[model samples]
Target: MDHQTEVNVGGPRMRPVQERSDHTALVVGDFLYVWGGYRSISGEEIFFPSDEICIYDMRSGEWQTRPMEGDIPPSLSGTCGSYLNGSMYIFGGCNDNGHSNQMYCVNLLGEKYIWKNFTEGVESRPTPRDKHSCWVYKDSIIYFGGYGCKQIRDVHPNSFTIDEASWAVIGNALFRFWGWNNEVHVYDPCSNTWTEPHTTGSSPTPRAAHASATLGSRGYVCGGMENMMMDLHYLDLESWTWTNIVSQSAVPQGRSWHTLTAFSPSSLFLFGGLNLFCEPLSDGWVFDLETAEWRQFQHPHQDKPRLWHTACLGLDSDVVIFGGSRDYRMLMDTIAVLRFPSLGHCSDVLIFQTQPYSLLRLCEDCIGKNAEILEKQLSILPLKLLEPIQKRISFFRTAVQTDKKITCT
Candidate 1:
């Protein structure tokens, strides 16, 4: 992290909890649910899993602790989860004993919420592991590579269509991660079956702690460190191909334990995590998937670096962030909310955000276009579109004058 970075807590969330890291938290309706992670006790760091569910209400901006009703999960970390339908599905993580292949679900909207052991009656389960990435894809929870019984790196149901294949063994399984995997596995929520699908495109290197969010049929993963990943990849669920987003401007440094949340359908917000130097980063980023561009969100206004924390988008463009550690300081049980300024309207914008960057890169094409075509295009350029393009050109012009390379577009 740069010296200018700051990580002050935001919003109205103001209670203190034990300093913790590697905890899993997700959004369900009006509440953000936080569970199991490692916490410090008398200078001895330990797994602090508890049955108590930590609930943060977006509407009230308050914390409410509730006890679990059934089959409470044990103390653990590295487990990942996704919210689908009305319940949140949590799968495999390690505990004091070891890694667990167990899967559980809790109904967030129910009056009396209880944990359900959905792992029961399942066949062809992913090996017990932690640091694995999983997201809800339609009717299934799609799981990607992680650490397990051993390093697993194969895509299930590889290459061929879903057939009358046995769950015991899959046909056409593509071996992606001989050591670290980029393989994709689909877990059916209804049948409780796991299938490895054949993917066609080149895959990401075996990585862990990478943040993922579902955008339509694509899953966006960004800023994970197999070593140090500033690179971003999106998997097309239908084609099983990966597209790496190459952006101009200053990209957020590669870091893990950072949180990535889809604040808007077309955009995502990524915030605080540790850098390659093991420094707590207060850096923030806004990724416009529509433009495939990464816009850095300045963090000079805050004073705490968030690492291993979780971010959830609440109503009215608010980013609700939960606890994570910053260097030696385990954070207070504080909830911070960063409110994004309104960008007004794009309801009539017709220009592609990437086009400006593209035009800046390849000027000949812009020069070659007929005045009629260009006039039509320029006529509808909304203030939203014009502002960024002007900014990019200004930024690029300065770079050109400075003899620095233009990485835009």
Candidate 2:
């Protein structure tokens, strides 16, 4: 019910010459850890993979570059990851050569956070792929749909059926036949085993550069190419059924390479992707998992297109979008905070006093600033404090009208 918009929290004032796109950034406590992504310059078709890791400190509001230790991962793009048990597990990504099935993990809470390869121990694994979706369910990391190790057919636009029309039409080829991977693989760290779960009902088609977020036992996925799909699908992990959620709400445009961060554990915020025209997008949308609705957020940064970037739900349900490529322009360093409505973060600024006037004045200030979610803050306020805040709001409105009349005379 509370609201916030994207605000650029500038960081990494000085960036390295090597920029990247299609990377992943994760939030662990107050820091955001960024990993490998490919870079595309304006003229060249060349893609340079980043081997280093960048850390953005929320407390300092700056970015730090760190060298990868232990066995380092190669420059990769369209990679996916999940953090659990004090360690982050990284799966498939595409390098300069091709997609990789390699898996690795880094312990953030350990004495020394180092990367360790675990792919050799797993006998069965998902094929080398990139632009896949990954989410944590219980203790297991579930991997689904991305480009796989298969020969792809580049068919003309005229050949694809209407249902599969939205799939990525890369260059002259309207449909990529084989590269669209539709398989689902689940890895259990407890057993170090990979298993393909049996999924029933309807499921999503092969896709790449899509995003997924876990809400309790259920997993929701949306927007990707191979079919530039706009439909939202949820998997009731308990029943192992994929239900294509049909919402009365105006769904977002079918996009690829977007970021979805779970806000407030139950709600989700989606941001930035390339649309059907292959143009980069900057618009943001909020989706309620319970109601199956999508509402576009009104933000000042509507013109700042972002794609192939990483966004994470940070301190107090605030969604942060950072480090993306705008068209071919590389944006490897930038921090944006989508502040959600929450009193938890408000404590830093709001000083609660015995007098309700203090809180009332704060409410009036928020209203003066044209903050849309002023009403939402009331629900979280103590019952005893509500009356004073409401009274103060009414008095302020009346004062404003009187001032307007005096000016008119």
Off by over 4 Å in 2: 1-18, 42-51, 151-177, 328-409
Q: What is the lDDT of residue 41 in candidate 2?
A: 41
lDDT of 2 by residue, 103-162 (tens): 888876544457888877678787677778877878888887875443244222332222
Q: What tens digits encode model 1's per-residue C-alpha lDDT throughout 243-319?
A: 77778656778887677777667887787777887677777788887687788765332455666667665534456
Model number with the top TM-score: 2
TM-score computed on alpha carbons, candidate 2 = 0.70
